[model samples]
Target: MAGLSAMEKKLAEYKCNTNEAIQLKLVRFPEDLEDDSTTFNPEYSHQVFGDDEVAFGFKGLKILLYYNAGNLSTLFRIEYTSKVNENFDCVEADDVESKIRKIIPPGFCTSTDDFVSLLEKEVNFKPFGTLLHTYSVHNEEAGEDITYQIYQADMTCPGFRDYHERLQTFLMWFIETASFIDVDDERWNYFLVFEKYNKDGATLFATVGYMTVYNYYVYPDKTRPRVSQMLILPPFQGEGHGAQLFETVHRYYMSSPTVLDITAEDPSDNYVKLRDFVLVKLCQDLHCFLPEKLMQGFSQEMLTEAQQKLKINKQHTRRVYEILRLRATDMGDPEQSKGYRLDVKKRLIGPYKKKQRELAKMRRCLRPEELTNQLNQIDLNMQHEQLEESFQQLVSDYRRVLERLAQA
Candidate 1:
């Protein structure tokens, strides 16, 4: 809610100014990254350099930025663009360092060579705790059983808090805000996913992905565990690991007495899909959301059951209700299909109705011609078509989730 800090403001400025003519300021010192300690992502460089910016071989340069423990580390890697360098107005290392210090606070190494050497050092990343949950899924295509393990660790865990710093750097590459949270605050909880396989008569583990949850206090003693950043590394995506991680976190909170309903912070489209699937799966087991009850239409029973049994809030519970109801309705029956469409349409029309009310209130303030012009822009005909199209697409999406739910 607060305004951006000086470093964030400058970074934003840098992002806006990036072009072929603008030379990179961080290229002089790799350790001069914007150190927010709150977020980082290598892909974010694209925000400044333009999407998929290519460096034609050592004639060009690439700049990377990351933050750890309140220290910024900038990386300047060169490619084959030597001829390209002669045309740009490059700043000397001293000026570049002075420019960086204006934004990021003081801390950490300022040497590019030392930073490169540190990256060259080998580091081991593995499961941070004993197994919390394990399940085997049959990969029909491969004709093999794949095993996944979910592990839990807190900020208080020995060596885990520090190890998480190294592990979470992966977030910078995938998540836009890849910086580490303050683990010393002791309010963050971590969940990790790993795949177990055997090699040379020994067991091996590969890091699949992870999620971070922050506990926010409600009135009195209750706590809300809001999911922060969740990443299923590219190699582990497209499988059901996301659902596995989400459901595991949901179940963990469901078992705790002091925790309230779970929530997520600015979830992406993929996460929303995975969450809907998992919530539907979990809700199906409750009596209130059974096929018979879902067909009876939504009621307080469904909301109360979902909140008490699964820690799902009322808004999400309503969404789950629509999805389940769609699954229950048979499109072959024209009457049942019409009822579902009407239900979804009513929700879709809410924004349009609100706009109409706003326009009516504005009638007295505008000239007759201006009012006519504004009303013409409403285009109710197009709105109706859009509403129907949206409802149809929604039903199609719901069907896909239902099919997956049935398989699961």
Candidate 2:
């Protein structure tokens, strides 16, 4: 046991945290190559590294992947103080390079000088597809208004497929459970955001973030556009880029006569919040969602108007109504607060009601002995507790939406 403890202590020194060891940078100029401010780390490495996200057999590890800001031409390098080799015969070092090579495309520059040379060509790289919208955001830190543009792009666009290959590599880092989509499918639509800046008296563009939507055919003639993936790089996050990207995409589909509604595939909490904010903002302006109408409770007219005006589906329209209703409610008034809580709790009880109906059917169909087992599975008091918990959690989420709406 003493000898085993000594060997274990020695081995621990070789393990490196993959998330910390990896360094990512988006280089805009030659000077940015050495600027520490340009660097950011990946939020996830488990897809490349294992569940623990550790790289073994390196004492001081630095896995550098730098990309040109405009075209995303990459530079890959690995540095370390010491590495485990044949001398540590009992344990094998993690093959970090091979795993990364599979994800990062071929033809990446291996030297800093080569990467700098690629930056010069960035001036010629222009955003692909038809430019749809342009907006400027005030960067408090830079003390200047920065301009951004959103473009509707597709795989058919010139040079976009190759650019997308490099761009989609970011999904692996930023989005959990992200996988490469079939760009070959004509149904996939791409929306991209880029920062338009003037360098050397000429306009140059840098990639900020992008989103992908896949259109599924609805019955008869309409189509349903489902947002599949969205990502805002670390440097550009917290500046309303995500909201802009999402809203732009939503509006783009709104103008189409054949679009049924917009939805998302396995949306994260952040995405859901963004969606709620956008939907409420859009619905709040409509005549059907006036304060008096919201106070009256959700109506078919509200649902019809939301679907017709914004292409919002029934489920989302109901949610938007709840949020708008919460905004109109006066929590200070006991009567109004009670009405609002009951209204929301009614919706929250839907799943439990569904289960109860199923349980009733089982009771009629199953034998007494089988019914006993089923009855034992559910506790009525616990069900009430869960319903109250869900209702509270929902109100908390709605309040957050209202706060952001106020700020907006």
Candidate 3:
């Protein structure tokens, strides 16, 4: 038993955290090759590594996946101080390289010298689509305004489909549950953002990030465009690129008469905050959401105007209304704060109220034994506690939205 315990301790030394081991870089210049500032780590590795996101039987592992910022031509390399192999006999190292190969597409350069050579071709690589909007953001580090352009592209565009395959690879590292979409589907719409820069007296564009929307057919004629994926690469995040990208996409859909509404597929918490900020900013300018109307409470007028003008659906409009309403509410006044809390709680209680109605009907129709089982599932006192908890959480989220809105 003592020997076995000693062997286990020896094996534990071989483990490496995959998240730290994986290093990504978007190389724009030769100097960036040696710059640590250009490197960013993946937010997640569980999808590539195991759920624990650890690689077994490797000591001091570093997986470098670097790409040309303009064309995203990749260079893949792995370095390790020690790896468990036949010498261990009782243990084997994880097949780290093979797992990474499955995510990165074919035709990637494995040689550093060869990869550096590919950067020369980036000067000729231009963004592939019609430019929809152009804007500049102040880069604090650079101390100058950097221009970015958002473009609308599809599979039909020449070379875009191939470029997108390379682009989507970043999603795996950044998004927790990211998956590639079927570019073969004609209904998919792609919105890409690129940084337009002047390189060697010639203009060049570098990939910032992208979004994919799937237009699902709504009953008779309209289509509901659901945002399937949105990713602003790690390097470009916290600079307001996401808000610009989201607003641009939302406005693009708002102009289309056939678009029923805009929605998102399982939005992350960060995405929700982005959406709220954008929606509130958009609605703030609308007459229906003016302070006078907002103070009157959420109305059918607000819903209709938002849906008709902005292509925002009912549920989203209601949430936006509550956020805007909270902004207009005077929290220091006891009467005003109570009204705001009760109004939000009423919306929060909707699901429970629905279940209660179902329970009442079940009491009338279900067998006594069935009703007893159903009654056991719900406790009114517990629900009241839950309702209060939900209301508090929602108010907290609303305040955050208001805070961001104030900054905007």
Candidate 4:
């Protein structure tokens, strides 16, 4: 720990102890197929676990899979534990049959001969995509029209459950701590975005991205919708698809009287940026956040308007004020820049200033030498340095947002 910084020293104490990886094998109808003839390499494989490297919440951890062709009958799954892997647990198809019995959907057979016969009658049927909302945009460079549609669905929808299960495979590739959810619960709602296009003279819909939100009851007729997972696949990123998806979800809830507000669970930095941009855009159109009011500084008027109109919490509302104020500010002018810095630092220094007042009271009960020791713990110089560092970082982040706003 010699020469290590305070933060680094703290991190050095933590450790990750990992053993060998678990290999789960499932051979469907092993009896019917010839020995070693039913071999397959998963077309897609995804692991679902928590941050502490444990299954933590569920009965056990799981690996969702899809075979060569993307369809319901081709899907397979497994759930086991670290003990199973560490103990070198050898499981046969018959051993795991009961665990997977309830998981298999109706009409799907575990019997190899029957399952193979069912695939022969299977048609590559595309499930009907329910249209929740739609908007049109033009390909500015190509001078053509592009129609984007957003669909909302529940777990009870037939064929949709299979579609969603397959879609979550993308999360393992994109999100760091992403885990699959229990789709059997009706509280979960899905929002899907797709591009409606014409290929080979037939209208086709290609997926762009999706978001999953859980509705939590807020007592006495109110419901708070918390966004659990959101992803705009790599191919469609940087095209403002994220913003569109967010605002569309926001608008959906805003229209409902029973909904209190929307929140995100342990949001990542990129998701925070998307939320800020979407909120700012929505708030700017309201009369309370116009240039004159924003320059006057954040007020009760601003807080009330944001909460009533958009359901944005007070903490987020304050941050939005700073962002919009920065957009309206003339940073090149020394006076304007200094004023902005002072406003932010005032909020930042509040806790430090309160600590100073508390220390004065402690002086009454302690000796002069003891009082000095306690006072020394509250370093004014360090507080000032931290305040400046925080303010500068905020300004840098605000500038980037402003640049994006200009482009938008």
Candidate with top lDDT is 2
lDDT of 1 by residue, 1-408 (tens): 245485344333232222332222211122433333322223343322335433221223333333221111333332222432243344211122333233333443445566645432312334676567898777777799989899998866676765565456556446764455777777888998877765345555656778999999999999999999998765567788888889998999999988879999988777777888999989987889888888777799998889888999887898798999998889889999888888878887899999899898879899999999999988889889889898888888788888999888
Off by over 4 Å in 1: 1-44, 47-126, 138-143, 176-180
Comparing 2 with 4 on lDDT, the higher-scoring candidate is 2
Ranking by TM-score: 2, 3, 1, 4
Ranking the candidates on lDDT from highest down gives 2, 3, 4, 1
Cα lDDT of candidate 4 equals 0.67
Q: Report the lDDT tens digits of candidate 4 across residue range 197-298.
A: 553455545567899999999989999999999987654577788888999999888888888888999999989888888888888777888988888888
Per-model TM-score, in order, reads 0.72, 0.96, 0.95, 0.67
Top candidate, metric TM-score: 2
Worst 10 residues of 1 by lDDT: 21-30
- Residue 133 of model 4: what lDDT? 77
lDDT of each: 0.66, 0.91, 0.91, 0.67
Which is superior by lDDT, 1 or 4? 4
Question: Model 2 over residues 95-168: C-alpha lDDT tens digits?
Answer: 88999998988989999999998899999999999898899999888899999999999988888998898898
User: Model 4 residue 125 lDDT?
Assistant: 33
